[model samples]
Target: MFAMLVRLYLTVAGLLLCSMLLVQQAFPYLFPDQYSQSARHEFSGELALLREHLRGVGIGELPERIAALNRSNPDRYSVLSPAMALRLPARVLAELAASGTASDHVSTEHHHVYVRLDHGDVVQISYDESDFPIRYIAYATVFAMVLVGLMIWLQPHWRDLERLRDAAARFGDGDLNARARLPGGSSIRQLCVYFNNMADQIGCLIQSQRDMVNAASHELRTPITRLEFGLANLGDTLDDRVARARVHALRCDVEELDLLVGELLTLGMLERSGPMPALERIDLSAFLRASTGVSAEELRIRSTHIEWELAPALKEVVVEPRSLGRAFSNLMRNALRYADGTIRVGAEAVEHGWQLVVEDDGVGIPPEDRLRVFEPFYRLDRSRDRATGGFGLGLSIVRQVIDRHGGEIHIESSPLGGARFVMRIPWHQPGEWRGRSRAPREEPAADAGHFEHSFHLQ
Candidate 1:
């Protein structure tokens, strides 16, 4: 809007300046007839009186003497011959040369100039000087007028801009109730109306989100409390083998419920957690070796082959230590549950970062389920309900953690005829992993059918 006002001012100024210059140039050309007429009248009256004066002086040739007077007074009179004044009717010349005068002033084409002879009309001459004053006056007037017009045009617009800026600042500062009011009869009143409507929509959306969080929390808290209380009461009554078995099952159910509730809460919190998890440089070799050792006992029960080919240069990777550890654990759990012949875990330093691969020889994930398997509470096999030892959040958590670390995950059918999960996490700095690779030997596969049946129960 301010730009438009500037354009308007420039356009007006340009047109006004051009108009003024044109008038200054054209004024003299447009008034030739008027100048001629006024010049003729003044010259005729002066020349006639001069001729009469010559007659009184006893000059026989009055016309010739008047011509001589005009020649002698050329500087003081029009360049036309004085005798040309007689070309008017004899009566008009007589009246002009009469002993008495009508008025002392005569109007020229441009202005008024008064003339009078000292005595007996010996000489009479005058010229108007007020016809054209300085051209700066016109220019200055135009400039001032344009300045005033621009101020008038921009005053309301500036106020509107100020109001919009103030409202935006307040809104950004979280003042949802703040509003920008337009002038009652302003040109941009509609814009202000739309802005207010948009603010209203945003406010509604925020309120709805808060309400959803509150309702979900309330619904989930009740079941979690009941499960915790039931588990506590069961522990008090357990003594015999039968009671102990029932209590153990109850404990397992309670643990599952607690994990589910914790995951849900984590999802909610992570969505609003503005900052990424804290990052630090980590030695990938040491980290992976430690993770493998911690889960070695569990993996031994599967009797599945496991191999590692960690790159010598895949040492330190920049990641949030806790989140990265959790992600790795989730991946390991998934692989251990489904892998049959062998699971290969390795890292290779690539151009951008350290690339980690976890491949196995179990039934590969179907093409249709690859993407859906990453959604919360989503499972590939509909017949295998999540209640049967699956919560469907492992891959979802993997994706969340990878995203927070600015990494990417890739899925493909591995050469080993099983699903493969690849992760690319950036190195903290270049050339930081100049060391040796560490890996463990492979083991045999577990009894295939035995593993399949016992896996879900575990």
Candidate 2:
């Protein structure tokens, strides 16, 4: 707010200074004769009075009379000798010689007049220049008043803008209920109304999408369960081997469809706008071990070696256990499919949070496709076949889970020559942790290295 005020003040100040300069430059052109006419009108009376005083006064007594006039008047009075009068500008001297009276302005504040007496003395009348500082002080007071008025005008507008900015930020961060509430007389009231309308439309659209996905997933479950049961019964009745194999294939297809529906349901749940899931404080090391072990056992990938690199400093983290566990399981299963012989699942302490990494020793994802891999139904060309690829909702669900935990996940090139999925989650969830007891640590095997512990599958 201070920065914004400073910028506004500087802009206003610059414009005012520029306007003063432009007016100064254009004033003469705009009113060329006004200055001269006003100056003449002003000093005409003074010149007449001086002339009356000097009339019939002898040249020798002119200096005494001028001194008396100077002591009584605010303006200076002087008598110029013929030689001194010769030093005047030719224009002024000529004008005085022709009209017996002349006026000249040295600057905007300094004015001078000359009159020719009958005794050949030039009586000079001029304004004093000592009031220059007073003029500057007046200008400064005016400018200060203008500054105060500007500040008064900007205060309410700045306050309104800040409220709008905060509402927009909260809305962007997924608070669909956030709205900018401003006074009716506020200058930006229309803008606030527009923003609120936009937010409403967007919130309704997202809610609609979630509701549709939920409805579809629920609708699919019944048919999928019936088909699975029918396929199982039909397979049992089949006698021929080829027919049984075909029935098994159909069952597999139905199972895949059911899995897809389940993923869609989970995605919809994660995307719902509401309070977060209940959080539990769990030991990072135990969670990693359990998640990786479960995924390996489920996939039955015994040939691949799993290594754990748990940082000692990382003790416990607050998270929704079920959702985070599912995310880690998905990452492990993904690594299992692409790993050549080894997979690394590791956790380490980092600034503000902890880092979880799952990497394999297979071909790394291309840089261009790393981010897109987290989009639902997105897969690389090489993983297009059913044997290697999933329905492609796994990584999308992983991202949603991380987002729910107020964390971020990204893919990087692994040191082991494959795609590395890194999840960074904060150490604590707001208003969630209640100081639970830490899980008992598992002792490392004697052969485990100092940097990491290993769980050999085969």
Cα lDDT of model 2 by residue, 1-458, tens digit? 67877787788878887887667566634664475456557788877877787789887787788777778774488788889999998867877878787766665456677888877788877885647698678768877877787789889999999999989987776667889999999999999999999999999998888898899999999999999999999999999999999999999899989989998998888776577656888888888788763444544544777888877877888788888888898888888878887888878765556678889998989977876888888877545656685778888889878766666677778889998887766667545534322222234334322312121100
Tens digit per residue, CA lDDT, model 1, 1-458: 66777788888888987886666456534764454346556666664564455445432343365467668645343222345443534433453466322122233223321222323332334444444566457768868888788989788988897897788766653456658898888787888888889888886776578458646866877887887788778778877788877877777777777777666655555444245545667888788766642365766777886788787866677767776777777777777777885888878865445577887888989866776777878866566433335577777777766655545676778888898887665454333232111111122134111111111101
- Once model 1 is optimally superposed onto the true structure by TM-score, how far is the C-alpha of residue 110 displaced, in angstroms? 48
- The collision pairs in model 2 are none
Which model scores highest in lDDT?
Answer: 2
Using all chains and alpha carbons, the TM-scores for the candidates as numbered come to: 0.47, 0.84
Collision count of model 2: 0
TM-score, candidate 2, is 0.84
Off by over 4 Å in 2: 22-32, 40-49, 67-75, 80-102, 115-122, 128-131, 293-302, 429-458
Residue pairs in clash, model 1 = none
